[model samples]
Target: MFAGSNRLTIDDKGRLAIPARLRAQLADEYGKELAVTLGPECIEIYPAPVFRTMAQQIPKIADRAKRVLVQRLFLGNAVESEIDGQGRIGVPPLLRDMKALGTDVVLVGAYDHFELWSYAQWQANNTEGQTHYADAFAALAVP
Candidate 1:
């Protein structure tokens, strides 16, 4: 039930700390292991078990082309990491390059995972979402 946004900085070592409030829940549910990967527009952090479930779902895809696409988008770039005692997870250079992560990043809660977006990208993304909110909400049947 992660539901908030957190603004954080990437340390010199490229580590981003998970917000304290969410640390305990993550520790309890997934221990120190996490699976990180590139999303369409951001880096996504997932509990190892949660990521395993997601990986399992990929293979069930019936469309060969779509399945391959999912595999390449997810499996190909996925990296397994461990959260340290201070609650920090290291973002690999490749992942950083792929997502264009700058020093400042925004961690947006996304139910099953947290999305990491550069500050500028997050701002732009929010602006886009704001413009489409009415139509998006209507599509979701929100009244």
Candidate 2:
């Protein structure tokens, strides 16, 4: 049920604090365990339980090659992590470097998980739907 966005920062030590509004939901429902990995255009964070469920799907992909590729890209790069008492989570150096995310950031609540995007990257990809809205809504069959 996670939904919405927050502007945040990764401190020099590379920790980002979850907003207080979402902190309790995460702590109470998900516990401290977490998994982080690089996603298509941003870094992804998932509760350990949720991540485990996704990991299990890797072996079920019908295509052998695609399954293997996904395993390596998703599972291979995942880093186990947790939220600290101060409510901050450590962003793995690898994922941070890969996503160029050492500064201001955008934390987007994706139904079951969260996405961390570099501020610049977010701005670049979040252009107003001036050009793509029609195709996008059409694809989703929205009226």
Model 1 poorest 10 in a row by lDDT: 134-143
Which ranges in model 2 have alpha carbons more than 4 Å from their true place?
128-130, 138-143
> Cα-based RMSD of the predictions, in order?
1.5, 2.0
> Of the candidates shown, which would achieve the greatest lDDT relative to the real structure?
1
lDDT (Cα, tens digit) per residue for candidate 1, span 79-133: 9989898899999889998888979999988997889999999999999899889
In model 1, where do residues sit more than 4 Å from their true spots?
139-143
> How accurate locally is residue 58 in candidate 1, as Cα lDDT from 0 to 100?
97
lDDT by candidate, in order shown: 0.89, 0.88
lDDT of 2 by residue, 12-78 (tens): 9989999987888887888888898878779999999999999998899999999988888888889
